[model samples]
Target: MNDAPLLEVRHLTRHFDDVAAVEDVSFQIKPGEIWGFIGPNGAGKTTTMRICATLDLPTKGDVLVNGISVLANPDNARGKIGFMPDALGTYADTTIEEYLDFFARACGLRGDMLAKRIQSVAEFTELGHLMGRMMDSLSKGMSQRLCLAKTLLHDPQLLILDEPASGLDPRARVDFRELIRALANQGKAVLISSHILSELSETCDGVIVIEKGRLVREGKVESLASNVSKNELLNLRCLAKTSDVEIALAEHPGVLKVRESEGSFVIEFDGDEKDIADLLKTLVNKNLSPVEFHWHRIDLEELFLSFTEGTLS
Candidate 1:
């Protein structure tokens, strides 16, 4: 991956009248990295993204796409970005194919070029069969797929998606995640915002979190979890007696504390994955039979609650 970011938001601050909708937010998206932008309803996620897309101006700072300032050269920057809003923005009487073709034309494609882009995005989004279908008739999941197809029509390097998986079913959300993964693997920089943290945790390489209008946290999911967590726990279930298990774990340097819970030993571990693995190895070396041993890491949902106060901006 390139050391330089394909999309960079530098000290961005946006004001609606006297109220700061987004305040001094900064982050960078390297090529091929899929990042999640998260916060409460009034946390200024949309405000920040709109400025990044060049649809809104910041009161202070700026957004850069491929090193072009979004504030100074919005048209040039826009060509390098694909921005998808929370709403589908479907037309009243447009078919899926019609919408794509129209946008392709607007993007300066003519004849074969227009036809090819329309076909390519449609196929990638799995909207080929539904090309003739009306946009208004799509399900929430299908509408999001169509919106994604539209966004990809320009083959932009950076993607800004807001709440794309909001109302999707389990299967649709999974499909959406796979699509995002595919995009990132193909070297697109993606910045997505959503309230569904579990899914975000599964899909994103890392996340940038904000509270109200200011940045609160930013990093990989596991890294952020470590920062917010007091300590990590290892849940070990054994066929052996709890006393035997505790005795076996006592010799390991990584085991901080061990308490019996039901049929398992909830061990407070003071190390990383390698240390955890070594602990398990040591227990087996002590001739203690083990059935289950795994770390209980903090997930994104818990991390989000820990990071932000659910207040509107």
Candidate 2:
């Protein structure tokens, strides 16, 4: 197995005349990892993915797939990457199997090898039953699956999927998530974009958030949530009224603010685990018995909101 990163983007920037679609973005995806590419409308996610797929040129910077630069060797880069655009166009007259077969042939697969690859992807994507279905007659979810199967026909190491689950139903989304996980387990690197932050939080190993074409943040989901610079929010349910507990917490240097909730107090603390322990000790020392203490970790949605001001291109 290759130890190098499956995909690497360094200072990627794309300009359309006077408009900058993407600017100075950089990130990497390792083998067996699924990275979520997230941003609002017109945030340059598509442009970046296009450049990574070798379908578009970058005004500045470069993309490397398996250590091969896309700008320098686009054909080689394309050979290593399979790109599925957000809006997949299908041949209205062709069947699902025929569509995949066309792409397989285009990718230079033939004979038993081509048939084997098609059947393998069809089975993996659960599209075997839909093989004879017309592309125009398939549901959106099934169409998406067919597109994915086509992308996988080439057996690329890195898969770049743009808004893959955009129109999927609940069950379809669940199945798609499982498929992505299975791909990662098979040592394929997946870079996917989606507007569904909650689902991304559950499915992605990490995420790269960009806004106005600039990279805002990139890290593992849990790491990014925990590393947010903002004060940590904690909830405390005390055996007694939170009056004394509030006062005690307010006096502690680690506690920034304490607000009363229905039956507990919400504390904004500026400290780490040791500081939290010290604060709890101080509360207990003040004769305040906390029946429940829970630290609220910042979720991906909150972190995204904190970075981007809900701005769209």
Candidate 3:
């Protein structure tokens, strides 16, 4: 990836009359990186994405796609960015191949170039076999892949995906993640917005979280996890019941929070090298030694929930 930013949104604000849809959001996306633009519904994610995609004019502030100003030259900006909205439409009579061909022609591809682009995108999205399939006949997952294929027809440098995996199953979601990683590896700067924290952690390089129409946090996933839960607790499986284990660790100073999980107990603490040993010694004294113990890492869902203070829709 180059040192220069592929896309930059500076003080981008959008408002509907007196209501601020997006409030002075600023972020930079580097080449070959998948940046997760995340937030709950009505958090201004779609509004912000539309501005970046040149589909909506910002009430204030500016956006630059590959250094081209979106406001000053929207046509140029459109050429550099591909937008996949949450809802997509497909013509009932058109086949998958015909749909891609239509978009390619609209994007000004000609002759062999159009054919190659259509074929390439079809192959990339695993839609080669569905080329002749009518749009209405395709399943939800297949249609979503077709939507992505259509988005790639123009071969834009930056892609803005808004909840692209909404209706996809687990297997289809995995395929979608691989598709996104492939795009990033091919040096495309992608901005994906999704409420699914697990999906974002699996695909994105960094995350930008918005809340109440404002950017609340932005950084590496590991940074968020480390900041929220440091020296995470170990899940201890005790032979005793939950009530007995809770009583045994109640007075232990090394333990911070104790909660029951399934049939086991989860003990959290700021355990130093000696604190871990002390915790085990304390447990042994009560004749309630744990049969299994495993360290836990805080996931993106936990980190996001901790910071956002609510469910992401």
Candidate 4:
């Protein structure tokens, strides 16, 4: 793959009347890379992505898909991008096969090329078995798969997936993540948005965080993890029962704060590797009998909340 960016958002701004939904946001996605577009609701993520997908016009700046200007030449840019939106338009009385065929023709595909693309995406999304089923009768998971299959019909180099993993079950989410990785391996660049930070953490190479219509941060996942959060997030669970885990953790001078979860305690520790090991031993000696003790350098949720004030524009 080329080192150049397949998708570039340069100083993009979008407004409706007097309110700016997006303000001076910019990011780049290189071929075979996955960049997560993340922000809370009303954070202009959808607006920014819409501009890149040629679904909305930018009030300022430009977006380039495969170096083609979407602002000036959307018709040509459309050929280079595949956009999977949050909702698939209701095609009443349309079968899965019929819906895909409609889009295949709309994409200017015909004859053997059209048939090949339809079958290819169907197989890729595992929609081949449900090809005869009505679109309206499909479950949320299947609908998401269908949305992706529609997006892939054009074989675009750049893919914009808006909340692609939202509402999906665990298995469906896992399959979607693998699908995204496979697409990137085939030399496609993806800009995906979702509220599920954990899923994005596992799949995205980097992220673009937008808040209140402004660009806040954009960098590699690990780079952001190290720079944005300095403290360690530890999850501690006991095999017997939830003990005075907080009191046991307090024995370690490295622990900063503690919060309770389902059956585990989330500890905020400003400790080194040795401090962590010492904390484990300290808990064991205290009769906490920990069954699971895990620690991670980053929490995308905390990183998100720390940067944004939950303000809506």
Better of 1 and 3 by TM-score: 3
What TM-scores do the predictions have? 0.81, 0.84, 0.92, 0.84
Task: Provide the clash count, candidate 1.
Answer: 0
What lDDT tens digits, residue by residue, belong to model 2 across residues 1-313? 6778999999999999998999999999999999999898999999999999988999999999999999999988888899999987858789988998999999999999999999999999999988998899989999889889989998999999999999899999999999999999999999999767877988899999988899988999877876664677887888867567766776789777666768687677888999898878877787788788888666678778867863210
Give lDDT tens digits, candidate 3, residues 1-313.
4768889999999999988999999999998999998888799999999999888999889998888999999998898888999977959899888888889999999999999999999999989987999899988899888889989998989999999999899999999999999998899999999988888898989999998889988998888766765545777888877777888788887777776769776667776868887888777788886888777666777678877884321
Model 2 has a clash total of 0
* TM-score (C-alpha) between model 4 and the true structure: 0.84
lDDT of each: 0.87, 0.88, 0.86, 0.88
Models ranked on lDDT: 4, 2, 1, 3
What order do you get sorting by TM-score, best first?
3, 2, 4, 1
Off by over 4 Å in 1: 234-294, 309-313
Q: Residue 285 of candidate 3: its Cα lDDT?
A: 80
Better of 3 and 4 by TM-score: 3
lDDT of 1 by residue, 154-207 (tens): 899999999999999999999999999999999999999987788899899999
- Give the clashing pairs for model 3: none
**lDDT for residue 76 in candidate 3, whole number 0-100:** 83
Span of 10 residues, lowest total lDDT, candidate 3? 304-313
